[model samples]
Structures are given as structure tokens and as C-alpha cells.
Target: MDQERIASAITRVRETLAEHAAEMRYRDSEAIATIEAGLRVKVNGPHGASIVTDMPNGVGGEGSAPSPGWILRSAVASCVATLIAMRAAEEGVDLPGLEVMVDSESDDRGLLGIGAVPAGPLSMRVIVRAQGTSDDARAREIIAWGKAHCPVCDAVERAVPVQLTIELPGS
Candidate 1:
């Protein structure tokens, strides 16, 4: 294991987070609501986009909108790819033409109105394809670093904490 390389990767990610924190706060400056079955987000502003996401049933839309779950999966894969590239570069591992596909599965037993079998984002599998010098070794390293660095993967693996507030009509 390359300790110095790993340290460098961590430093770069920290710096990136610090650099983007303010911009994120500025851009993500709205709030929304949703029920327990899923999450409905209403980002107010001309540039904001309103999104309704559910577990498996799908994201509702007016006229041919993509499913939210699919979007989420895409986001996960994209994040993994980005993190892998960044970590691999820092680790002195050459990576080229990298692409990742994320797949998720959920059982519909409970959704069929049966007993409460508990449904959620069950499992996510990632398929990575890339070519470069030291491709195999870099692929291995990227697989490891991707699981460690991706925020979406972290949210899925580590279970991020979320707090919800609802406004009452009379209040």
C-alpha cells in the first residue's frame, strides 16, 4: 500500500471539499418536504428543479421524465468514476477511458400490499471499465478508492443522518 499516495488523495479531497463548501451553500439554498414512503424535494428559484423520488415504483413526471431512482444510480456511478480518477491520479496510478455503471435491486413483495417486508435501496453493484498503463493494478486501486471516497457510496454504505421538519397548517 502506498501510504504517501493515500495521504495525498485524502488531502486533495479535503481541499476540494473546502473549496466547494461555500459554493454548495450558495447554490443549494432552498428547502422542501416529502412523506416517509419517499422524498419530495422542492428547490425554489428559477434555476432550481423540483424532484420527487421513491424507492422503486419510480419518480413521477408530467411528460416523459426519467425515473429518480435511475438518476440516483447514475449519480452514484458518476461519483464513483470521478473519485476513482482523482484517487488513481494522486496514487500515481495511470487511468484512462474509465466508465462505471451502477445497478440496484429492490424486492416488491411489500409494495404489492402484502406484509411489511421492509423495502429500501437494497443493493448497488458497480461495473467499471477502463484502459491505461497498469490498467489492472489501477483498476484494483480504483475499486478500493471508489468505495472509500464517493459521497454517494458513503451515503449508501455509511447511512447518512437526515433530519426532517414539517410545517403545520395552523402554526
Candidate 2:
């Protein structure tokens, strides 16, 4: 119930992270994931391309695209949705429709023309929608809680340290 105590706790945790940052590594792993019986993914890509299984309805994608990054982004949105839903439920709020729209900007200056953004997704925008029962204050509170709980949102907002290791096939 004390804001000062909560703030102190958070500060202590962050201090711990800073103390152990040098020992931290961005550990990576992969697993074979199947979407439906038809779509599968060869998660560990020793080769340049990952094999895709049967194509979806009409996209001809074999229901597979680049993994890891997309999966992380989807997880971000899912985290937001889940946290918001949980908060709303706890507060006895009813929402008819809820959605999160996320997009990223990439730079293609050299590859494209002038004023092109960048070569990677520069930013993401999430628009949350909710039709609730006359509880706008609770809705806003839920949204705030969602933002506060999302790991991806916290990482981006706080600029977490990242260590990069690129392993070429022969390297």
C-alpha cells in the first residue's frame, strides 16, 4: 500500500540487474513448433533457410515465415492482451471487444529512396480497443496495468542491456 516501498523494491531489483549485467547473456534456443497438423517449422536453422510445412488457406506460405523476431512481437501483443484481460476481470469490468494493433517501421534508405525509415522495425504502435460497461476509469486502469506488466514494453522503455552474437554457418 506504500508507493515509496514499491519504488524502493523496484530500485533494488534494478540494482541487482546492473550488478549482474556483465554475467548476463542473451541465451538463445529453438524448438520445432507446429501450427496445425499441416504447418511446421524447423526452428534450428543450421542452413540459411528454415523449412516450412504445408501452405495455409491461400497465402502459399507453408504457414511459416521468419521465426524468433515475429514470435517475440506476437508475444508482446499477447502479453498486453492477457494482462489487460486479467486486470479487467479482477475489477469486474466487462469488455465486448478488445484488440491490439502493432506495427514496426524499418529503414530502407539505401535499398529504397530518400526519407525511407530504416532497415529494421524502428517503432511499434499498439491501439487497444474495448467496449466496456460504463467503466471508463476501470478501463484506463486496466490499460495502465497492461503497460506496466508487459516485459517487452518495460525492456523498450527502460533500454535493457543486450549482448549480440552472430554466428555465421562456418564461423
Question: Which model scores highest in TM-score?
Answer: 1
Question: What TM value does model 2 have?
Answer: 0.52
**Predicted candidate 1 versus true structure: per-residue lDDT over 83-109, tens digit per residue:** 887777566676677789899886666
Q: Backbone clashes per model, in order?
A: 0, 6
lDDT of each: 0.67, 0.63
Worst 10 contiguous positions by lDDT, candidate 2 = 52-61
Stretches off by above 4 angstroms in model 2 are 1-41, 44-69, 109-119, 164-171
* Model 2 C-alpha lDDT per residue in residues 18-50, reported as the tens digit of each score: 999987677554434446544445543544534
